[model samples]
Structure formats: structure tokens, C-alpha cells
Target: MDHLGSWRFLKVFLPAVFALHHFCHAETAPYYSFVQEATSAPLVSYYDYIIVGGGTAGCPLAATLSESANVLILERGGSPYLDPINKTDKENFFLPLLDPSPHSYAQAFVSEDGVYNHQARVLGGASVFNAGFYSHAETDFIKEAGLDGSLVNDSYLWVEKKVAFKSPVLQWQSAVRDGLLEAGVLPFNGFTYGHINGTKIGASIFDMDGHRHSAADLLEYADPMKIKIYLHATVPKIMLITEIGSRPRAEGVIFEDALGVRHTAFLTKDSESEIILSAGTIGSTQLLMLSGIGPAHQLEALGIQVVMNQPMVGQGMADNPLNGLFIPSPLPVEVSLVSLVGITQFGSYIEAGSGLNLAPSLVQWISKSLVTILNQTEAKVNSSSLLGARLKVGIIIEKVNGPISTGHLELQSTNPNDMPKVMFNYFQAPEDLRKCVQGMETLINVVNSKAFSKFRYPTISTQDLLNLVATLPLNLRPRHLNTATSLEQYCLDTVMTIWHYHGGCHVGKVVDQDFRVLGVDDLRVIDSSTFNFSPGTNPQATVMMLGRYMGIKIQQDRHS
Candidate 1:
């Protein structure tokens, strides 16, 4: 057998894991392994490609590239298994986001705008904690990104077969679907994965049994011998070489294992060897700034060496502005997570999630926000008082499109663990607010529809429903739509996140259409971070596709 064939055959029988954990032992013994602790890696290693952030995009990217090259993945967090937070059962859907541990799969951060959001620290990235709704990137999105339409479709197919599944619509979701149709959202598209303008039962990354299949599962598609992933490996900076006549080029990365031991992973001598950052919106931008590739002034301010003086590294920060109402179900509703959606003529997408199991702390956490929002001094609030007895409530939400409003991320300290100061300035743009208002109007119609009468109060008028939301602490969510605050203020006041935030290393500003950093060579940012807009209602599907799409492009580039 050829060397490649021999390696492949050898890995099958030789224990799928490598335990040569010591730096010295690993350095001397070259072997094949999968999903190893960072401690198992050598102090110094080389690869044809190195991907930072073994996340939604990173997993597929590393997997695809491994077909013809050796790849190393450095992830800042631990495995997604053996933790209640990472459990895929529908009942535990929100556990990952609510996990109190500082080192859990999801890391909570309050944006400068004071909006609570999450960053995924686990290997699978945010896909591990997300709603699991799957949708395709709009055709307009494909064209806007200058991607090959055919390749985009094929990439979507590749991801769908691996992760996407038919969403099982239960009672609450069925009522939601009927309500959307009755509300005149448009001709129903039925069950589909397409990004369309109508009510549709799209796909889900969760299987029929409720087991979540995240991007990490895509690693199985990789060439076993050519891929090595290090969990709990934090990359502090990208190593760059600045030649007098040439642009700055990324050569490797400096990462620290869980033990705080530093190590270097360099690229092979091949001219095509590249370093890609699949770290999400915040991580990719933060790493770029930390590695001296962002605003020179900002870098210098943080005591970081400026390499490229790229001023737009952390610019164009934005998130979909979400507004929703919590309706206390009069009857028991089956547990579901956004199984039905209503795409309005306006730029908003309306979706619903049912049987939300909100814990007392989560209820209190949200109640605190509500208590402050209600200026009435006499308004007393507690979890039980706000939610009554059961925390089970149906959440109906709409996200405005083209939040066109933009913000920037500023590094506070040089510390990699310290979250960047980000303010998406949600609904700063007039269009986003208009869309939110319109979307909310349609959502009210859905609630008032006859099909949903079973769940909502029969006597409750639209205004009464709004008043009802005001009473729920979870309803106390960005959403404070006061102009007394931008555009009516309700959007800003109630605007919570469905967690679909993108931009930072955006196309045209930070990276080229090919996702290569504009001022650097052999370094690429390949995540939703590079997107100018969040594609469709969900970006995870597209994020996963991008990894496969670009992996093919990069492999093709090597051949050329």
C-alpha cells in the first residue's frame, strides 16, 4: 500500500486515540489520533494547515482540508460530551446556556449595550447550545458573498446529510404553523430547508431521538490520519512574518494547554500552507486584534505589537434584533424548540419555541431585568409571582433583518480570556426598527388567529396580550421599545438575541471575497465573522457549509 493508504489502514486498528501525552514523547513519536486533550500534543508541532477554534466552521474546515493535508485544531474549551450542558435531549435544550460554571460550553457576556449573549467555548461551538433550527442561506446571500451558487448548494447538501433532519412538529408547533397560515404570512411552503417567504417546517440539527448532531460530528468525514484536534487549547496569537517587501504572512500560532504550558504549532514548508481562524464573530476579531493585525492605535493602546495596522478588524459588529412575547399556555404543550417559522413580507422572520424549561435562577435573572424596566416603584417581582407556578410558556419571537446598525469591538486588556467590549447598537438603524414593528404586528395577528385561540386567552385583545407580556419577567427581555431611549425604544428595550450575531472581520472591510485577510498572506478568517449579513434566519447551516466550501476552494488553490 502507498504511504497514505498505509496510514489510513493503520489508524483503524491502532486505537482511535493517541496517549503519547508528554511533550517529549509526542515529539519523538508521530502518530494518528482524534479528539485528544491539549496535554497530549507536543510542545512543538507542524501541520499543512492549522485551524483555530474547533467550532461549527472549524470542524468541517479541518475535516475537508484533511483530505489532502495534515491539520491541527486548537480549541479553547473542553469536550462536548459527558456534561449535562451538552446533552442533546430536547428537555435539556437550555441547560448549556444556563450552566453556571465559568468553563461550561457556553460563556455568558453582557454586551456594552447591556444585552445578555453567549459565546460557545466547547469544541462544537454555538451549535451545541443553539435552537438547532436549520435553514439555507438565501440565494441573495450567496450572490452577495460572491460565492459559487452551485458549490453553495452542494455544500449545503454536504452539511444537511450529516447534521440536518426533518423537524418533528408537535402540538404547540402545529398550532404555530396553523396560526402563521391563518395570519396571512403568505403561501405556506410546507416542510422545507429553503429560505423562503412563508410559513414552513424547516430542518433541525437534532435527530428524531433528540440527539444533537453538531459540527464536531463532521470530523468523522475527515481523513483520520491527517487530523488532530486539541481540546482546551487557547490560542493567544497568530505568529506572523513581516518581510520588508512582502505583506505580513501568518506562519503558525501560539497556544496554551489547560495546564498553562505554552506551545507552538507551525505550518509545513509548502507555499500553500495556511492558517485559518474559524473562531466565531467575537473570537476571530479578538484574535486578529491581539495578534497585531487590527487598528494600530488600539493594538498599541493594549500593549500589543502592531503588525498590519488594519483599522477594520473589529468594526461592523451587529446582531439580529429580536423581539418576542411569552404566552402562558392554558393547556399542556409538547416540548419543542422553534419547529415552525413565519417569514413576513417585511425583513423579519417569526418563529416559536414551546415548553421552555426555565430554571428559578434563570427566571430570577430575567425578572431582575423586568424589575428594572418597570419604573413603577411599587412593582414587586419574583420568579414565581411573574411565572405563576410552571415556568412552561410558549415564546413567540420575530427578528428584524438588516439591523444595518453597526458597532465595534474594543479590547480592554491584552488578556485572551477577557471578553471584548462589544456593543451591537441593536436597532440603531431606522430600517431595523421599522422591520421589528412590522414583524411584531404580524406576530400579534398570529396570536390573535383562531388556530392559536386554544393557547391564548379568548378575551385577550392585542393590547391586553402586550400587557400580559409586560407582566412576565422573561418577557421583560432588549426589547424596551422606547424612543425615549431609538426608534420607539421597545426594540432596544425588549431586543434579546436569538444569538444570530455576525460581522467584525466582514467581507470587503476586513477580508476579501475569498475570506483572506486583506493585508496578510496565508491567513484567513473563515467564519460568520466575515459575513456582512447573517444569512437567512439561521447562520449555523451556512457557517457549516462555508467550511466545506472553502476547504474545497483551498484544496483547489493548492493544486493550481
Candidate 2:
């Protein structure tokens, strides 16, 4: 055939083959139907509601809202469905954490006190990146939050059906459960979701087949035509219109796409049309402060025009503190995330997991954490020393249900791209330290129990343990060495965030009971930031429940 004739023939042939392939594989395609690239979004769009941050809370809230009204979700990151390396494969789970590319799913951040943390910059938010441990908040926490009992209860079911799953009990997890019961964390609750005061096997996002069902799965609830999800869309500011004496109102938002093209999205003429910030803890608080709904002094310092002098916008941030004991196992254990939890009498939650091959980035992180804990110079200890072995079991002791010693978030500058300054003032309160100490003691007791003996091979001697604990950076070490004091100091030095950061724009202070941002018209925060207090559990389940409840509440209010 001639060159021109051949070119025309190839065009016709390629598309036919492509279409045939797509048709054959249609059933295997990812389930997100309404998502679009940021560049594809219209330059000027209108919606009844605009949800910033297509994350754990934002995804569900947007899906629910779309059932009643048009909704727009502007996410700063790409879709997890598009990134199989980071989102789908269980063996390559840590790839996202190790990735430092501009488009990496996990955006790394550091706390002011030097602890490192990462936040998900994907459509499913942290739900795509977390360990997938699912647990409901304690009954006491529900009552404390003043949430409607029935609504909270029903909301869990709504989220659970979409994302939660029962993780199979493996060898390591079974041993941990037995050890917890042996340690007096009695009343084994088998394969339940309730966060009761006893050892329990809970639901997980990772299923038996090892595929994670993230909160993004909840997008199935959205009305496809009514929902517009734009990935890689960064909202810089919430546009507001104000009068001399009248309060400020959010009219729209200005966002930038991946190609650096700017666009605007506005609310409908309806007075009830609203803007919701579901940008997790840090992102939501940062966006609020950037949009002038933060401390007067802080905003003024950054030269950001103040919309409202809400001092509490970036204050009262809290993170669940975690300390763990690593047990080297001679036998290989199944690769798993959180499945079994021990709710101790001393106000701590104990969970166990196995089979994590630490990524290079995590190894570096462990080295830094060890340096801080041991008060040693960088040369003395390296990442290899901490994570040399494979086949290791981790006993994670978390001070989930304990005293809430909060922290604060501060803006580095007016730039939205610049990371915010986070200060999780862990162990600041006397009660918080006491709780951590008690939790550490409980972990020691559990490890020493005969139930754990079968798996625990004397990896480190008692003297070595004492020496390791004695080298902790905490100044207040007992003059005469003892296991109790050593463990307490180790906890003080080694405690890190479990990634359960909450309460920046909390209820009563930043937002109202209904989640409306205080003093701001037509705006609300419905993420972890809106949490009144940290629920004493893994927090993903509670956050999703809150998202569902808020979504339903908004729908009800609109109808009424």
C-alpha cells in the first residue's frame, strides 16, 4: 500500500483493536466513573456544594451530597485507581511512602518537635495509604461528642458495607490476641467492629485477597452526572465577599490545575449552597488559615487578609501517640496490617501486625527516630541496626483513649505550597505522660507473658533491654535502674504519632455542632479537623461515620 493509504488504514485498525480490548476488559476496570483530570474541568463551573480535598471524609461526603445536589470535589493529588503501584499491590504497599516524586501519593511532613509524618495526597486520602485497621469509637466517646446515637450507629454500616472487611487471623495476630488476654486484657471479642474495653478482632480495609478497599470505594454512592471530581486540582483560597458590618460569605474558590491553569468554581444562587473543607487535619487547617479564618496575629503576620479572626482555627491539634516493641520471630509470618486490638484497663489500645519489609525511606526515618531516642550522634547508629531482620512481629501500644494534650499548626508563609508548621506537643501534660508510662508497662507485661513466648526468641537479653532503654534521650531517668523506669523513659523518647492527627477545626471552637465553620457563612469543615476530640481508636472508621452522618444531616436540612 502507498504511504498515505497505509497511514489511513492504521488509524482505522488501531482504534478498532483498542475498542475491542476495552470491551473485553470492561469488567476489570476501576470503579470510579465520575472522576476527571483537573485540566478537563471547565474554566468556570457551578455547583450546589464544593468539597475541597477528595480524601477519606471528602470522598464519602461528596458522594452522599451528589445524591441530592450537584457537587464538585477538587483534590490536590491523583486518583489511587490510576496508581496501581501505590494503591493496589499489597507487597508494594510501601512504594508510595518511599516515592519522593512531585506526584507521589504520600506527601511527607515533619512536626515541629522533629517527628516525621506523611499525609495522603490522593483521592482516597489517608484511607489509601494507611494500615487499613478499622474500629469504631468507644461508646463513651460517642456520648462525649454529643452525636445522635442512632445516626452514628447507622453511619458505620453505610461506610462498612462499602470499604470495611474482615482481615484473616494469621499466626502472628493469633499469638498477639492470646498474649493480650493472658495479660488481663480479658473478654476476647471475636471478629467485631465495636471498640470495647477488651481484646477484639476488628475489621480491616485489606481483605483476604490482600487488596485494599479504600474509602474511595464509597464514591459508588455518588450520582455520576451530579458529581464532578477533579484530580490534581489545587484550591489555593476560598473566595469570599464581604460588607462593612455584615459577616463574610464564601462565594466561590480559585483553584489551579496540574498544568498551572487557574479556574473558578462558584456556588449556586441558592442561599443554602455551601462550601465544605474536608482536607484532613493539616490541609483543612492550612486552607482555613490561608483563607483568613485563623488567628488574627498569625494571619496578619503572613499578610493574609483576614476574613474572620478565628483564633482556634489552627489550635488544639492532637495526634494519637504510639510506642512499640519489636519481637524477632524465627518463623515467617503472614504479611498483614492491623487486625487484632487489645483495649487495656490502663487506657491504651494494643494492636499487632507482622511482615513489613521496611522501605529505604522508612529505614532512614527509623534511624532518625532511633538517634533522637538514644541521644546519640548520627554516626553511632544507622537504619540497618534498627531494621536488619526480616520475619519480625510488632506490638504497637497506642495511647488512644487518654488525656488529650493538643498541639498547634502554624503557616510558614502565605504560600499554599509551603508545608505548614506542625507541633504535636506529645507528653506535654502530666496525665498524658502517666498514661504513656502505664501503656508501656502493659506492653512489657504482655511480651513477657507465656502466650507470646512461643514466638518471642530471646533476641535481646534483659540487660541489653535495660541498656537500650537507659540510653533514651529523656533526662529524668531513675538513678537506680529498673525495668519500669527504663520502659517509661523509652516511651518518652520513642513515642511517635500513629497518623491519627485530629482536632484543628474542632466542634464548639472552630465549627459548630452541625459542622458549620464558626462565624463563616456557607462554609463547613467535615474532616478529622472537625473532630471534637480524638476518638480512642484507629479513627478511620470514626472519620467515615462522621462523614456519612454529616452528609445525611445536610440532606435532611435541605429537605426540611
How does residue 447 of candidate 2 score in lDDT? 73
Q: Tell me each candidate's TM-score.
A: 0.88, 0.88
> Runs in model 1 with CA error above 4 Å?
1-33, 84-86, 363-390, 459-464, 471-487
lDDT of 2 by residue, 1-560 (tens): 99999999999999998677656544323556679899998899899999999988898888889888999999999987655433454545666776789888889877886666888798889888787888888887888778899998898999988788887888778878887888788888887888777889889887677777777888888899999999999988999889788888999999999899999999999878999999999999999999988999999998999888998888888887777665545455677778888887777888767777566655454444444543432233333444543334354455646546888999998777778999888778877777777776677777777877766545443333334434443222233445425665566566666888888897899988888887879999888887756675688888888888889999999999
* Model 2, CA-based lDDT: 0.78
In model 1, state the lDDT of residue 231: 90
| TM-score between model 2 and native | 0.88
Q: What is the lDDT of residue 146 in candidate 2?
A: 80
Cα lDDT of all candidates, in order? Answer: 0.81, 0.78
1-560, model 1: which lDDT tens digit per residue?
A: 99999999878745543332333333212233588989888999999999999999999999999999999999998776535322655667877787879788899888887778889898889988899999988888888888998988899898887888899998888888898899898888999888899888899988786767788878778999899999999988999999889889999999998899999999999999999999999999999999999999989987899998888889998889788777655577777887768888888999998776666676665555444443333323232444532354688899887678999899988888989999898777888888988888788888888898888645435554454455444322334433222334556566687788799998889999899999899999999899888998888999999999999999999999
